[model samples]
Target: MTQKSSVRQMIGFITDVTRWSLSGGIGYQLFLCLLVVFMMLGVFAYLVQWKLGLAVTHMSDIVSWGFYIANFTFLVGVAAAAVMLILPSYIFKDKDFHHVVIIGEVVAIGALVMSMTFVFVDLGRPLQGWHIIPIIGLFNWPSSLLTWDILVLNVYLVLNLSIPAYILYCHYNQVEPDPRKYRPFVFISIFWAFGIHLITAFLYEGLPARPFWNNPLMGPRFLASAFAAGPALITVLLVIIHNTTVFKIPKQTFNKLRLIIVISAIINLIMLFSEVFKEFYFPTHHSLSAEYLYFGLDGHNSLVPWIWTAISINIIGTLLLAFNPGKNKPMLLLPACILLFVGIWIEKGIGLIVPGLVPSPLGEVVSYAPSWVEISIALGILALGMFVVTMLLKPALIIEHRFKAEKPS
Candidate 1:
């Protein structure tokens, strides 16, 4: 291997120390092992998806978009949330957020990886994954939103990963980061993060047949939900990192998290309400989708009940996190996190996919039931995400710890 490649691998190998610890530890090792086993299983199932076709999953002509697309979109939302920390720190000169910008970028990287992985799994003709390459392949450069998503997500990923990795390298090497050296790239990160999620939302909103997805507000709603879910995810991740190691987050960091959570949560909740009102006020055949969401337009339903519960849980969670920031005690924070995740997952995953399938534009009603294999595969992807986060962030955290000790904190 080239010397540069060797050095990168060595850095990665050092990062694997946490994997080694997780493999050896008594309590947490269980999760580590499970993450591995699940990932392997997921990979096997993906092979099945590739070998067979999309048939292994429950997708149909009516339900062209299923869990994978949903996962992709949700991950974009998760990835975009990192801007809460990254932009405010770099652009606004918030030194407090500077402390965790690396962490935030790493989280964005993790989410981006999962989002792209979902793209690989979602394609019907898996081998056609390469068709989008420009000079070497048949490029759908103009028409498809999938194409745009592919471009934006990947570009954003490189920018996000580069910024953090470069910063961390400076941290590890005990060298000053030439602020001038990275400023242009940092400016790009601010726009790239927004672009990634906006393109994802546009991918759906641009679709005309899917009235459920055809709202102008869909894009902003996505950003709002992303803002909420992303920060909440980061907060949980911060707490997890704190609890899992000797590291501790001070009150100041927690305060920033609380503020971001509140602002984002309020925006997200308001967006949901506006969505409901937009449907009710105009009351078109299009209104049926929102009706489907809130009050079950027809006898056709397994989602409305759970969706109502999800909305309730989401609203309550948002209220608790946003309004009662004082009660960020672990118990409150934990449930609030669970509720926000579930709510957004349902809204984006089930809510988006299922309703679009229902009372179809052609007036067909079809439902998707993912098989054991498919469900396993999806769980495996999530496990893979968790495993990757553990592997990538652990060594970085250790390095950060050493940096904090050596530098004037």
Candidate 2:
């Protein structure tokens, strides 16, 4: 593969992706239309925010980060969770998992793009984003965790994109992808995935001023919840893909993923219990944020319902998976997976991010709720992620189906 031939092949790949994505069934076309509407509305809302400023949002000096950052935090975990599939498929050489590993890469690409979009939208002055660029801006290098986050995330995104592109290109051309060519990058991605999420965790835990996020367990808890929620989402997606397309996912694949979700969810709940007990048992000044989160502080209990709802759902979801692990039980498995996905969304997003900044470190308590503008922009970003996944999956699925049909029995 010379450079010119590689570039030409890449262009051909893009053309195929566009053609397949656009030529889907009625349901797919309708879904794409719906996403476009939401994306347009988000753009209009963002333009309003850009014109008026951060005043359009509910964030104040007391709670500088709001809904956007919360979603950004959760999506980073979702993005990093792709390692669950990559590790088993590539490192362990699980044949069933190899069939769906490309799907996980597609999911990661959508999620990483969404997470970055959330960060960009949260910026009050979007133009100042250039300040984080390596040469064009200061970037602050090793001194700033934010700089580290930016570096790892972009690198991970490139790895996910390139690895899949090379493999799928070979499949498209009916050639075997040389392990020597792409295997090293695959190995790098496995480790890079962990680094991305841990760096994100350090972004919070390193802040001593925010005692709520400063726990040493924060990194482990992040990984635990991510593995659980990320796999849960992927499970539901694989089910949907199996039903709607020619791609056939094996029963054992779901079984293996279910086990991972159950173990990770249990660990996440145990960690949650440990943190809760540590806070309420001996009640110190450091527990003030957790107190405010669960029990309310000085008559402020905005997050009490949110936290309890998340806890109850997660507990119920975990039990459902643990007790009912049958291979073909989509009725039980689907609901449990959906529950875990939604519960962890709440747990990792609002439940985690808001309280860390609520008390303002000076004992001043403030409340935060997303404005309509924020809601619209967040929905738009989510819609964009779905669009990306749908587009990428169309071509990838076609390639997978073709290769599977060609394989010798």
Candidate 3:
């Protein structure tokens, strides 16, 4: 536990985590290759889209939102989820998640990068995305949600990931951690985590013309689903890592995440039902967005199928997690998490994209299916996120293992 030994340990851990993310075992290497290959295809696809315009995808004026936006929204929810783990451990002093907190941060960083990338690609001219930068005259602080989104996304990303990294790093290295000296940094992270997704949800909800996005309840609903899925992902990941490595997730911590999954899952379901009731109770054209989701309306049958799928998966997933939790087998939990992940993906993807198309901006339906190019590019981003998480966690975990090993028996 001497300073030099601690520093060496810290360096080793950081290097390991870094290696796992970008370069690691054969599996990690293959993952990196997969990510690179997909991204290359995405770049090629984008070039084609730019050359021919976004028409390469099914995007039309009627269906302005598409694959990129759907992924962006869902990943924002994914990224925001890290807070559920971090807050409990740090603020609430819930030590159950102490082990998983750093991994949560790593996942947050990966997911956020993907979300931002989607925003980047979704732009008409990707390079001009810097138009939101203050030095540029294009920034309309008072008028543009784009400006706010730019500000919140970057700031929150840094805040959410940095503190846990700094703390875990210092602890691993046996350094003073001294984040206690920067308490405001931790405080800001909590609120910032919440804000990033709120702003993201607002990015959609703020749109007055798009009735689907206009629901005032959308922001909170975004948060509920995020918390539900975020920790569940971490739980599944913790298990996977345990299987692959000597490290074992503490039963206490695992149980904690199980509790979190259940609580957040129920809350998410309740919010969905609330929105549905409000929309269906009154039942008007303004409610057509939610209606279209539950049951097909007009001629747009594309999302009707997915909407029911999302509802069933989410409802079932939530119930299982809520009741069974620690009692269920890990394999059972895996499916639950998978189901939740799929359910959210469908909800965000369909809810954001196709609904915007229905009734259009001017009251018309449009046929909107993501073309192969769009699907490929979207999957490429996802594959990249998974690849990044796999890489980063491998190194970060080694650091943790060394620390735990060095601990007194």
TM of each candidate vs. truth:
0.92, 0.97, 0.91
Residue range with the least summed lDDT across 10 consecutive positions in model 2? 323-332
What would the per-residue lDDT of candidate 2 be over residues 268-361, giving only the tens digit for each residue? Answer: 9999999999998998898999998998888889889888899999999999998885544888899999999899999899888989997887
Provide the global lDDT of candidate 2 against the true structure: 0.91
Clashing pairs in 1: none
Q: Highest TM-score among the candidates is held by which one?
A: 2
Candidate 2 ranges with C-alpha deviation above 4 Å: 1-11, 325-327
Clashing pairs for model 2 are none
Question: Please, what is the whole-model Cα lDDT of each candidate in the order they appear?
Answer: 0.78, 0.91, 0.78
lDDT of 3 by residue, 1-409 (tens): 6999877886786675565556557875776787789888877887788898878888877778788888888888888888887788778777667667778888898889899888887888776766667876467876777778788888877786667677667656655567566467867877888998898888878888878778888898888888888887887888887787777777787778878787877888888888788888888888776666667667767777888888899988888887775475787888888898788888876666677557765677655678887887887787778776766677677667777777675
lDDT of 1 by residue, 1-409 (tens): 5999869966764565545435545667777877889888998998887788888888788777777877888999999888889888888988778777777888888888887888777777767767678888877877988788888888888888777667767767666688997889998878888888888888878989888888788888888888878888888888887788866766577677877877877887888888887789879887776677667755766677778887888888887877666566776786787788788878877787667766777877654667766777887888877776776676677667777889874
